[model samples]
Target: MDSADANIATELETRLSIIDTIERDDPSRRELSGADLSLFIGVSVVIVLFGILVLAL
Candidate 1:
């Protein structure tokens, strides 16, 4: 269907834009900081805990 095709195209465009944004490192954009690191570590810990709980169950 035409609508489905359009939806696929839009999703592809969005993914491409995200990839481009990540690949292009502009100094004007905010750089990663300590808070980002802390958040990443916290999320990692949560994921590990959830995995352990699932295995225990």
Candidate 2:
């Protein structure tokens, strides 16, 4: 694979690992309440949709 392809793969792996860590219920990390979690879900969806819009443009 080319250098650009390798770089993109590495960045995606890093993001997935970070998400996995955040999703865990560890006390040391963020422990979102139900309301906060709902807000987060809404925000994440918004960001994803925005990204798709940018890509399409």
lDDT of 1 by residue, 11-51 (tens): 99997897678745655555778999899999999999999
Most TM-score-accurate candidate: 1
* CA RMSD of each candidate after superposition: 8.8, 13.4
Distance (Å) between predicted and true CA of 21, model 2?
A: 29
lDDT for each residue of candidate 2 in 19-54, tens digit (9 for 90 to 100): 778746656566668998899999999999999999
Q: After superposition, which runs of candidate 1 have C-alpha atoms over 4 Å from their true positions?
A: 1-28
Clashing pairs in 1: none
Q: On a 0 to 100 scale, what is the lDDT of residue 1 in model 1?
A: 57
The clash tally of candidate 1 reads 0
Clash count of each predicted structure: 0, 0
Model 2 lDDT, residue 56, Cα: 100
Q: Give the TM-score of candidate 1.
A: 0.46
